[model samples]
Target chain A: MDVSDILAAHEAKQKAIVVEKDIPLEVDAGFLTVTDLNPIDVESYNEDLEDYLLNTARDGVQTLIASLFQLPVTPSEDGPVAKLPAPTTLLPRAKPLPKPKPLTKWEQFAKTKGISHSKKDKKVWDEEKQDWVDRWGWKGANKATEVQWLTEVPKNADVDFDPSAQARKARKERMAKNEKQYQQNLARAQQAAGSASSSTPNATSNVQRKRELDKTLATTRISTASMGKFDKKLDGEKKLRGVKRKFEPAEVSSSTEKSHNLAILSKLDREPSAKKAKSGGDDVLNVRKAVRFASKGKGSAALARQSGGGKGKKGKR
Target chain B: MSTFRAFILTTTVILAMLRTIKPKNARSKRALEAREPKEVEDPRTVIFVKGTHAGEKVDHAMKELMALKRPHAISFSKKNTVRPFEDATSLEFWSQKNDASMFVLGQSTKKRPDGMTFVRMYDSRVLDMCEVGVEGWKSMQEFKTAKATPGHKPLLHFASDLFDTHPRLQQLKSLLLDFFNGEIIDSICLKGIEYVISITAGPLPDSPSTSSELPKVHIRAYTTRFLSSGTRVPRVELTPMGPSIDLTLRRHQDPDPELLKQALRRPKLKKQDIEKGLGNKKKMRNLEVDEMGDLRGRVHLAKQDLGKLQTRKMKGLKTSRDDADESDESDEDEGQVRRKRRKV
Candidate 1:
């Protein structure tokens, strides 16, 4: 059998077998269709017909017919097409642009123009306006220049002028004129230099001396006042120590008297005759003298008043 | 009445006669040109004339200077004044380089970011301290009643008498205004003053070039701040280019918005996006890539094959010529789109 017939028969048997086996018959339909159409020319037949039908079908019946028949059922094309012929119009054609004018030779040469002067001849140009400028001093090319002096000129003045001799003569005259001026300047400068050094030294010394005096005077005044304060304090301390020492003498006298009284009492207890003699006339006489002196002493009050006045004056100082 | 009319007519005639009688050579340009090269003292020099004290009136100073009948040439600085702390040699060098004029009198004023202004006046010779009226301060402390505590050395102060005078003070104030106002026209005048000074002083070869001078002016402000223990260092730089002075302070305790607006304040820093790191981190980071650099192999390969079919495209096109042609058409459209985007 031919390949198409064999493929189709195999697809039909497969569908029947699918039905018998309780599988869906639609599942084998795609396979059966492919096998049946394998030998047909797909490009010529429009194989996308199914896709078009699926896209366009609105009614259920139309969809079923489109699917069964496998016919294209898409929407109509949007518009009809056409072409128009090319048109032309009258217009001016573009023209080539003109070239710019070239710079002149004179203009180019003027940029490099120079002015020169030599021992033989001199040529000065007017740089601003480029041209062969007349040397205000130039007479003619053959004759000597106007700057060339006429005085003391040689027969061939143009060729024989000696600039060195003229220069030397000028220098000699200048030196002679300047000689006096130079000497005056030298004297003035020497005087100024000497005065400057001397005055500077004197000014510096004066300032230094003044500074030294001021420093010494300030220090002396300060130290003297400070020393005075110190001396006063030392005198005060000495006076206080002297008063304490004087009080010590009085205490010693009082202690000595107490010791003597104790010794007399012990002697009286040991010897009756000694005690009687000691207690008798002389002892009584001393006691009476003591009482009398004590009674008459208004002098001590006067002395104490005098001493208080002195202590008060010391306190004030 | 006739006599009165005659009197008026006579007077008119006399005036007309006077008008017609001018010196014969006065109107000639050649006459004037001949005298032009003669070194004559500038009659217009206005120095201190009346009620003169030191530093009070520039006019007064000029008048005083003119009395000497000295044939002095004047040059102006691009700035009103220069600081003493600035290297003299370098400044002279820059001034000469820029073809700046030099003068006997030189001055400079610096405006701090905080809006405080400091002015410095200079001279080739030591100025008479008492003559100038203000005792020159060697250090900042000498600034009278200064908010910032100054150090030990006394700073120079402008003559109080000068400041007190209405006209003198007004002129100085106006000068300050011009400076803060950013008047570019004044730059020539400033430089002219320097030039005149240099010419008068004779030749100084060490003058700095204009290019060098400009950068120095800009950089000096920075270096000057570094030397000072001033507060509030700038976070951004504002390059101001205008005729008006940028009066705004970069730092202040309490910012005055009106002042800032008047001063024409602008920020100098540009914020760069941090998210750029995240977006390009993984894909390109492995090569430690610099996208700006040339990629030789990728460029060569891309440029070499014009109609090469991609592997994915081969499968997708089903090995068909029409499909390949359609893909190429899409590619060309994409290329056009890319070119347009690139232009944007």
Candidate 2:
């Protein structure tokens, strides 16, 4: 039997499966991507860029498919599915890196003094309780003096001196001072960021600063007991321009507005929170309904008096 | 009198909404502050506004776009009495109130019928705006098919050289990219990619390109299917998902150079990244990230003579006592032969 014809056919079949290229394709199976870094044949590319691009894309996809077929697979509902590993490509963060927080007053001082920081834990060991508890808060270590039953008094101390009350007053003052400093630091940091970011548009940033300052001033002015309406007008204190409120015209014929209102009503009707509030809670029985049923529509007052009388009778028994 | 009363009835519900802008209480203040800019930014919220004379087509197109943009979208179904081209103060007001940075305004005036403007805001001010006229559209509702989950990041495919070459088309491409840009993710799962939006341009005229208007832009959405093709590798196919639209470029505005520069600014790279050869022009020697993103390195050593290297001791290969002297002589002769040939 002649095997030459069979050998030629086998050779042609092998050639169809094999891929020949100068540079090997880099297959990232995790990402399902294949990158071919081989230099382009400039003559063919210059002839027709679109056709060249298409051929290159086809080659890449073909390589990717070949690599994918070699991967280990598990039987899935749809068929055998090759599970893709987590992608290894490093993507740049979409937003800009966060700016470091501006140093607090104490932090700045410590820096100048070349002092290293050591963090203080929020919880501290209490010797009396023999357990860890909050350093400050309800029944905290800081308020130990205020809650103590007994206290040592100085020989020269006045009779009216209440040590517990005095300790509480001191703690409140410290808290208020810390809050004031925190607000100051926040304002300073915002100003720095605003100026730093808007360096190119110096004039616009300045305008923004002026506007922010005016807003703060207005808020502070109206924050008084009189709401700034009855306050004495200071010299050259320009009037604060408030946001104007404009309503739609009375004779408006637009169907859009009507439809919009209807939409809002429908949305509210569908709201779970509003429904829950109206029904108090679906999980619990309605007290009003229970009272009406128990008293045969006598109302909650009758139920309340009956419950109180029942409690009194139980105590006596 | 009845019409006047009707206006009051309509205004009351929206009046409650308007009151929410200033943050009357602590809870409102907290809610408003949640929209503040973060270090890693959240996806931008978008507001859709309807013009006084918006047509049915314009409204439906906006509605379908809104469907894709939900969870971060706010809709104003009312007819807004504002022209963006003339006065952008109204848009600014809406942006500030909602803390939204993007807007899709649909209007159909007699002068510019079937128009849709995309207004983008930066720092609560109008940065750049562009308007496109709607030629025709097919809403998502019409297509009864499996749809992509709302707010999923979509793969955008631009199918024309004009998108890269033509200025107007380039701007349109940029606008569309920004509009569809969702959460930033480093890696995506194969199955997670549910849909892709393909944008193609109409044919350009052969002559007098400058005088003629730019070609129409066709936007089509498709769902991807990975069919098992007898092998481990699956065959991919695209099925049509709807909300297909055709747009022609209209009035456009370029962003300010200074503002654009500020917007494009990138943070400084970390020292570790630079050492890994991820810098512009200062790559470290003998380092590379492999295809799997693993760091690969090369090492160098001083050259050595292979003949002088030690080998495992063996009874048969070891030289005898008398052969050792002969072997040393032969080694010297072999070394001298090379030098002798050089002298010759």
Q: Is the docking of candidate 2 incorrect, acceptable, medium or high quality?
A: incorrect
lDDT of 1 by residue, B1-344 (tens): 99889768865764564343334675665643432312211111111112111133333333323322223223231333433233233333332232221222322113221122222111111111111111111211222321211111111111112222334232332222222111111011100110000000001123565222110000001000011112111111111111111121121122134432422322221122112232222332223223554322222233547367455534355556565567798776776688799789
Report per-candidate DockQ: 0.00, 0.04
Residue A195 in candidate 2, Cα distance off native in Å: 8.7
Model 2, runs deviating above 4 Å? A1-100, A109-134, A150-166, A176-317, B1-33, B207-211, B229-233, B273-344
Candidate 1 chain B superposition, TM-score: 0.18
lDDT of 2 by residue, A214-316 (tens): 8898887767765676677889998756633346677756697788889999986664665467766543666667778987787877667777665534422
Q: Which candidate number maximizes TM-score?
A: 2
Please list the Cα RMSD from the true structure of every candidate, rounded to 1 decimal place.
Answer: 50.3, 22.1
Model 1 agreement with the true structure over A1-317: per-residue lDDT tens digits: 56998777766644422212121111111111100101112243246532322211111112111122232222335321111111111111111122222323333455467433235335555444454554433343222232345546557666756755665576557668778666765676666566566755766866888889766644544466343233334232322211111123534677798998899999765645655565546643455445446545435554455556455344221
Determine which window of 10 residues in candidate 1 chain A has minimal summed lDDT: A28-37
lDDT of 2 by residue, B1-344 (tens): 99789768655744555565678899979987676555445666789999998898889889888887787789997899877778786787687677787889999988788899987776556767789889878888778888998866565555455755788877776666667653443344445556766566655644675655677777777665665544435554566687888888889877777766665554565665565665365887888766576777888888998988889866687666466666687876675687689789
TM-score of 2: 0.57
